[model samples]
Target: MTADDRIAITDLINLHGHLTDRGDFDGLAALFTPGVVYDVSALGGGELTGLEALRAAALALGEANPVAHHVTNIVLRETADGVVHALSKGLGIMADGSAGSVTYEDTLERTPAGWRITHRVVRPRRTPLRG
Candidate 1:
């Protein structure tokens, strides 16, 4: 992958966190593929497919709409199929003043709309990383 590719993937990862925290569910969905698979089972939800399912899942599970999402430690790898795999940590500041953390295992592809996530697995972090 080129340097530009890496930058683009990192930006996409950051955008996901920003859009989700802002409760812009539709905007978040726009960042992914049409048949994107989102595995949130680690967060008490199942694998969600497509934009509509993603939107519904977010709305249903995210009763606490206003969240602060801090994303860090992004690492990316490009595969033979031209898809990029990104791993990042997300730390959320809940509306109720509680904090939660998860690691995002993402597969991204270069789409007509730009780089989009094709799959994402959200794994709850037992112990968050700090620096």
Candidate 2:
């Protein structure tokens, strides 16, 4: 891939993180393929597919907790045609009245439309509030 290709992918993913954290479903869905396999299992993320399904999931999550997701350490490698393996670290600030941060690992790719997330597995980086 050319340098431009790499740059494009990086920018696309960063935008996605912004959309997700800001609860911009329309923007988020625009970055995916017709069918997106978006996973946010890191901090209550799961298999959320398609625009409609994912939108609902995002809405629910947004309502439950106000969030701020900052993405970093993005590494992108070409896997195959229209497919790439992207690994990035996401810092999620979840506000359940009170806010706390959690780190997540994400795997995503580029599609015909733009960049679309395939898998996002989150592991907590710090101890959360105990009930």
Candidate 3:
């Protein structure tokens, strides 16, 4: 991917976190394709397809209002299939006075609207086991 592609994809990832944490459901859904697959099963969240389903799932799974989400350390690569693959770290300041983190693995495609995420898998970043 070119430098512009990398920046665009990185911005898209960060925008998702901003919109979701700000409760801008429509804005968040607009960042993905119509049939985007959001797989959060690793966090006990099942796969949700389509914008409507994604919005509903987000509402259901989201913490109460006033949450903060931050995305960082984005790495983007263009796969042989012409898809942009992205990995980033997600940090959250939850409403319940707790903090958490996860790793986001994303597949993004260039769409008419812009570069949008087509599929994403959220996985827990495990700590190294004690020797």
Each candidate structure's TM-score, on Cα atoms with residue i matched to residue i, is 0.88, 0.71, 0.89
For each candidate, the alpha-carbon lDDT, in order, equals 0.84, 0.65, 0.83
Question: What are the clashing pairs of model 3?
Answer: none
Sliding window of 10 residues with minimal summed lDDT for model 2: 97-106
Ranking by TM-score: 3, 1, 2
Collision pairs in model 1: none
Q: Which stretches of candidate 2 lie over 4 Å from their true place?
A: 41-45, 80-82, 96-110, 123-131
lDDT for each residue of candidate 3 in 52-77, tens digit (9 for 90 to 100): 88778867765553388889999888
Cα deviation in Å at residue 88, candidate 3? 0.6
Cα RMSD for candidate 3? 1.9
Candidate 1 C-alpha lDDT tens digits along 1-131: 89988888888888887787766777875689889999989877889899889778768776664378888999998889898889999888887998888889999999888899999999987864688
Q: lDDT: which is higher, 1 or 3?
A: 1
TM-score of 2: 0.71
